[model samples]
Target: MKANKETKRLFVGGLGQAISETDLQIQFSRFGEVSDVEIITRKDDQGNPQKIFAYINIKVAEEDLKKCMSVLNKTKWKGGTLQIQLAKESFLHRLAQEREEAKSKKEKSTTGNTNVSEKMGGIDFQMKAVPGTEVPGHKNWVVSKFGRVLPVLHLKNQHKRKISFVICFSE
Candidate 1:
């Protein structure tokens, strides 16, 4: 029996944050064989972690892809809604190109500023304190602070050091 195009592998996208590869495989497996699954992540301006999306590839006839879409489109998973559709060859190609472009952009930004600059609201500090000095603590500071107290290193075996502190703040 010849395989139907509908049963061929199709790509699914617009995944929610809580969706996992295993969840996708299990969910889609009910309709057809899931060949592969991938979740995408990206960082925001503040260097915070963020989930971009996900893709699922199911092995089924072409008609099955449509069926899958109809069944799964606008579905909710783990409190997140999804946008499912048949992935055309051109769509996959476009995704690959976009990924490459994103990678290149990241590389360029790392090597040199790529005009993707964002203002950082706060500052970071590394301080070395004397033995007797007490670091003043601030309340309700504009920026969040994280500090570590460490033994200060002695220079030329001269003076005794108390602590070395490192602090970071976010505005």
Candidate 2:
């Protein structure tokens, strides 16, 4: 027995790697206006990624999902079963997490907590960010994950190749 709140996003799991975001967006369009299709993946210890699952966001309210949930759930898609659930928690978590982070950041700023970049005057390179190339002359800085600051090279990303964004840093 689900509640009557109208949520636009839905969690779609039990996905196969073969499914593309466009494929999902097209398939889900039959129910309502598909806003975005996000496929969440998992990374191995070696840093290689593997597909885990996906999510579909519709433009209409939860009533749209309620109308189409039965038809899409457990349906065979790309030779795999698709599981769909309302993304009520997704919305709630996003709001709650933002509030929590803002509070934490405020506390850190008030206490004069200095970051690594402030002392070192350079950026921390994670496994995926830094490219094997010279730094660019333009751009001031690049923000890292978890709102960390880093002065970095200007990166060029290709938008035409596919839906995935690929940024290439060059000399």
Candidate 3:
């Protein structure tokens, strides 16, 4: 995605304590119109402020933004390798995206009998069953299917002809 269309804010890292907002604006204005520059700082243990990083809001063409990021990222400036990246989307945007994903997953889950895999946080949960098995509600077949992953299995909704379970795995 293009930086100009997605976002104009850029996260800048590895800035020195001596650098100022105007200095950052001067360095970034070579490629585009820098609308604003913010140098973030935090107090150290000794009660002295230290420069952590900065954010730059620039208006530029798509190609210019790409070139600017390439030229500035990892470049040595003020005795530190600069790390430049497109800042993350706002919290509202992330929440909206998550809600949309949940809606789609809910829709997919309401369909016919099939295997479904879901990832939440750092855990993997897979719901599956052997369709062509002769014996109904066989736990050995289910365990054998996921033996490679060393799963922690939880069986539920058992019946004469069908068995549903959840298999969890950690990476």
Candidate 4:
């Protein structure tokens, strides 16, 4: 990934299961000012453990991302391998993608339910959202809210459909 004045963080994925944040910092700190490290985890199709992924935030000039990646790529940690690259886009981009996926899933489920109910004559599925929650409207919201936040919000499966909204302050 191309790194420049606009980029300050990189996402490191395909990590060995045993690697930790401290280990990442130790390995990556040599290039420049290392700020934060985060590991991404999720279950596989069979619900088995999966390789860990991470996002590393650096506090140096953007020019350093390449140097850092060069030093980190093909490096080994905790008996496992490492894949480092400048994070693509911002955290909001990820969140927006997740929201779209959830929306599509919901639509498909509704369609399937309708077809089944027509055939079985007695099947119903209800989905509801709690009160006072803001459902995300568009992908831009993610970029607006999390683009600058170093540790972008983790858009897990559960929060995808809840919508994006902010609580306004009243004086």
Among these predicted structures, which one has the highest TM-score? Answer: 3
Model 4 segments beyond 4 Å from truth? 1-7, 92-171
For model 4, where is the 10-residue window of minimal lDDT?
142-151
Model 3: per-residue Cα lDDT over 1-171, one tens digit each? 555432388899988778888889999998888988878888789978765788788888878888998999999898667999988655656656765785577667744633323222222322243332322333332233422222333454546455444454543
Best by lDDT: 3
lDDT of 1 by residue, 1-171 (tens): 875644343455555566778987898887777777877767689976564466666667766666767888888777566777655655556656755775576556643453321122222222343333333452212221222222333234246644433244233
Per-candidate count of clashing residue pairs (backbone under 3 Å): 11, 0, 0, 6
lDDT of 4 by residue, 1-171 (tens): 644343267778778777788988887777666778878888899987676788887765555666777776878767666787777766566668766775576467754465422343322222333333223332221222322101123333675654434433222
Instruction: For each candidate, give its TM-score against the true structure.
Output: 0.44, 0.46, 0.48, 0.46
lDDT of each: 0.55, 0.64, 0.65, 0.59
Q: Which pairs clash in the backbone of model 4?
A: 134-163, 135-162, 135-163, 135-164, 136-163, 136-164
- Judged by whole-model lDDT over C-alpha atoms, candidate 2 comes out at 0.64
In model 3, state the lDDT of residue 7.
Answer: 38
Deviation from native of the Cα of residue 25 in model 2, angstroms: 0.7
List the candidates ranked by TM-score, beginning with the highest.
3, 4, 2, 1
Better of 2 and 4 by lDDT: 2
Q: Give candidate 2 misplaced runs (Cα > 4 Å).
A: 1-7, 43-51, 61-63, 91-93, 96-171
Of 1 and 3, which scores higher on lDDT?
Answer: 3
